[model samples]
Target: MRPRSCFVRSSLLLCSTLVFSGTVARAEAPAGPQAPPAPQAEPAVEPPSAPQVEPAPSAPAIAEPAQPAPVPAAPPATPPLGPTRPKIDVYVTAYGELQFAYFNYGLDQNRAGGAQRDSRIEFDTNRFVIEVKGGLPDYGLEAEVEVEFEHGGTGSAMELEYEEFGEFDQELDKGGEILVEEMFLSKKLGANAALAVGRFYVAVGTLSEFSRPTDYLGTNRDEAETSIIPNTWDEMGVRLRYKFPWGLRLTGQLVNGLDSTGFSSQLWSAGGHQRRFEVQRATDMALVVRADVTHFDGFTFGVSAYHGDTTRNRPKADLVKSCEEANPREVAPCGYVSAPLTLLDAHLSVRKGPWSAKALVMYGHLKNAELVSQRNARLSNLLGVIRTPVSDNALAVWGELGYDIASVVGLSDSHHLFPFVRYDYADTQFKPREELYDNPRFRRSVYTVGLSYNLMNVAFAKLDFGHRRLGSSAFRPENTLRFATGFNY
Candidate 1:
């Protein structure tokens, strides 16, 4: 640009010199001829023009490219870290079972479906369950909910017990109970620890794992537990659990306890479940502690115990009832008798390759059974002379072993058939109350043989035979044939 300016100035000076020369020539009287103006193109040229055309601004535009590339990179780097999240998950699983059963003999005069009763062969729906689980990753919280349908009927109603003395009846509902068997909230304490609250299955025996129909090999949960203890015993509670590095776990729970008023000669503490009425009494609380060792492959051994005050858990009526017509011998129904219950159980489970086996034995003791039985006898029947005897101690034991036959037959891994055998013994009246004679009818044992099959990882089927005996050979034995089918996830 400087060179152009210099050339223009030099040209102007030279043009002035030429004009003077021409003027001099003209003035000197040479022929008057003005040189025609040379053709001019600079009229259209404006080298210094609008602001947008400045070359200095274009230099900054090139520099802007350097900063903006990193500007976009900045947003991208943050997005990869800021917006990412793990998915909060919810899962659903379900299981159900159907059974066809035939009893060879009647359990008692009042029972149905036997040679001496109403029907021998019958079809029934045992259990159906749908489970939902949810997790909140950011909050370290989780929840589980279980919905169950039993007996396969539907209604806008539910059946319940009419809580009254001398009443052995269920407020009848012609509909199935859609029960919320389990619902709980849990928090992760660490990698191998957790704390939970709400109504959930109690950790006492194999029931925690074998509560689902498909988890056990036999046609039903072994008879011993179902007879002496609460089957799938779930209670309102808080639980703490920790897992050790060496395949050992320890757990403790504090929960509401059973009602001694419902504990009887027949059902023992099993009837103490407070489902007959709303609002269980928490006046009597139980503490349960369990320890399990799984250090050996395919083996788990555990022991659990509980202690609670059962008398305080009863209905208020039982505490103050003084029926002169019923109990002339005693003034009142063992007025607030201090009956505490203690339960201890040991369990073992094994699963290695194609073999599955489990064993559990539970013993329960009640303090002041003489008093509890005396109160229950009059409560159940005030006018009757004879009364059902209650026991001071109860015992239950069961064991089962199974083997998978698919491998032996060269079948695919998805196919399975396990032939198993099991033995169960339960005596709610293991130790009869003092001053009452023990009935040989109280202690019972069952021997079962079954074949269980699986299909497509979804469905299961079972065929089994059961022989049940009461007391010694002096009592007649009961026999049963059963078939069961179900699907579980």
Candidate 2:
């Protein structure tokens, strides 16, 4: 009876659980189509949100993975390099002149009786020069080179030599020259100063300072300065230059001195320039100082001085004084005699409006000139020189004034016609020692009048007439007519 009761209870519980599960399944199943529900209004006050929950899956779908961030591209490759050149500035320029002249005087005026009545005509390519200027601005360095072709460069002439009584021979004469007028390197010390070294013009006269054809008014260079000193006198040396804000410039130089063996009455020290040998002698030295003031527009004034010892520059060192008690064992040139040369000059230049003028006064002195003359007289006949007694002093003065008639005659500025007048006086033997005679033939005065035509200072033509008078009235006066044409570029 008990076992039957337990079995009936178990069967009833199982039946109840199966009926509950069936009911749940029926509630969760999808319903048939029904009418839409109405929308409800949102709440005025928001309530706190529940924790996030994942949505239940309805169907399978395909998806792609996230992509990585992009990277930037690299720059283009660089090219290989080549050699780098230095930065330098360079310039080149040239100028030249041709001249024709007629003179009523002998070519050899220093003859015994002086030139009488010989007329002549001449044509010359006076000079041609090329200039090169270079600069390394980064280093404050500059260089200049000037090459001059004079009288058509170089030439040779056949000459008959008869110095010895019974011997006659033919010789070759050096007639012209090809010269290096200037070659120098300079370093700028500061904004207002510079230093230079090498061969350059000596700063003792106006010619050396202003050598361009357009710088002066005459057809030829100043005769006065040329008679006493080397024309465009150049020497190997060192130079220092300084400038002041007030338009003043100062220059100083140390250079080789002139050779005294070539000194003579006719040319004074003009021939002392060292050009006879392959190398120049610098046993003696010279000092030069120059000052120039360009305070005014188109006007300038200056002064310069030079001093040098000359005796030691001779070829053989022969100009020595004999010792009182000479010994055979003593070497040559026991004691050298001192002969110094001193030169001074003042110059002025003005070019205001239609007027232009230039003036200069130069004087030079020689110490122990008597001894130099005596020794020069005894030189070998082969040494070409005047063989005349040199004076102790020399003087030179010259002035030129010109008016640009182009404006006066209503011509354009591009065309210039200048009517100029010039006066020159030079005395190679101004004063002499008691033992020497001062030849009056060495003194000269010249008056010149000319017309110069130029096209903007680049090309020019000149015609001039001059009358030259000797110191003594008994000597015949000389006259000259000259024509010149040149380019300055």
Candidate 3:
């Protein structure tokens, strides 16, 4: 073989090996010719003539429409409506009273009149008023009941008017009495009207419920006022009251009065056999109506009228006659004297900020009345007479003014520096002169001034000065200075 032919064969063989064995990879694989053939003869030869086209006219533009606002989500419902506080609650309160009273007399005697060292250092339950009030969920019925501890006592202090002024250490089941202060069931008749029934406080007078430890004035239920309309008196009855949005409340009640007591065997028996045997004559029937108007944040004015018939019979003195009268199946021939007792009361109270003023007037008339000389068995045994005639009418007026100066003057935050004055005037029938025929006597004028400091609602200190003038010209005027400190819980 020739050398050139051998060389060519070898090179060909190497190339075959490289390709077939897949040892050396090709860097750029050859594809079909992408580069246009250098200017094809026809393309280079001539450029095609451009086709003719027309220019379009300018077009009008349109604006896009605005989108509507999205609806907002509502607020989450308020927590299930409920009273701020639960309906059930229990409270306990007590008070201790230390009082020093000074009475001065003997201005005319000239011998000596210094001070009576009668000081009272005692503790009073004041009130163990248990209150149960709540609204039932399913029935929506509202009920309230209050049991009160009324004070009772004996001795010279107890002989005075309004025995409630002393310490009450007696157990309610014993000497102390448990009184039905209030008990009523109420139902809502409308949005602002309510109907109620039960024994409840009479709807009359301004000061009936205004007595508080914070009050500086001394004297409760003035004779003329309370004796007539009987403040804080209660009777079994029905009532309706409405509250206005403008802060006015009107209430009306229909109840059994004094006569009801005589009819109730429960009350008669409750007092025991002695009382039942003692009280011979009793009341018959009575009716009462009252109206009150109150202005929001301003004043309250009220008027009340009551009429009733009271029995005027003295108990039979002779034991044999009484036993025969009370004989079984035999109705007692108890003598009954009919007498009409009518009362009218009016009151007005104004509260402007810390200053308050109140006035009240009560008038009572007893037509053709007789005073039983033998009012009780003891009295009859002591006096021998059994019946007496008493006829009279009475009028009583009282006024009070008070101001709270805590804001104007710097005092303890919990304290109220109050200066107060009260006045009372009344007419009486009892006369001191035994020889002269009993005439209408006027016993009037009660002046009081006091200041009270409070250490929160649980404690208070009071200093008061009072002057009272009686009808008797010979009797010296009475003056009283009182200082009291009280603690309560």
Tens digits of per-residue lDDT, candidate 1, 303-370, equal 99988888777654465434445665653544656788888999999988999899999999988888
TM-score, candidate 3, is 0.58
Off by over 4 Å in 1: 1-87, 107-119, 154-171, 320-335, 380-387
Cα lDDT tens digits, model 3, 53-118, are 121121111122244557799999888777565454334444445566666654342223322234
TM-score ranking, best first: 2, 1, 3
User: Which order, best to worst by lDDT?
Assistant: 2, 1, 3
Error of 1 at 49 (Å): 30
Indicate whether candidate 2 or candidate 3 has the larger lDDT.
2
Error at 312, model 2, angstroms: 0.8
Q: Considering every candidate listed, which one attains the maximal lDDT? A: 2
- lDDT of predicted model 1: 0.76
Model 3, C-alpha of 437: deviation from truth (Å): 4.6
Each candidate: RMSD to true structure? 10.8, 14.9, 15.5
For model 2, what is the error of residue 150's alpha carbon versus the real structure, in angstroms, after optimal superposition?
1.0
Report RMSD for candidate 3. 15.5
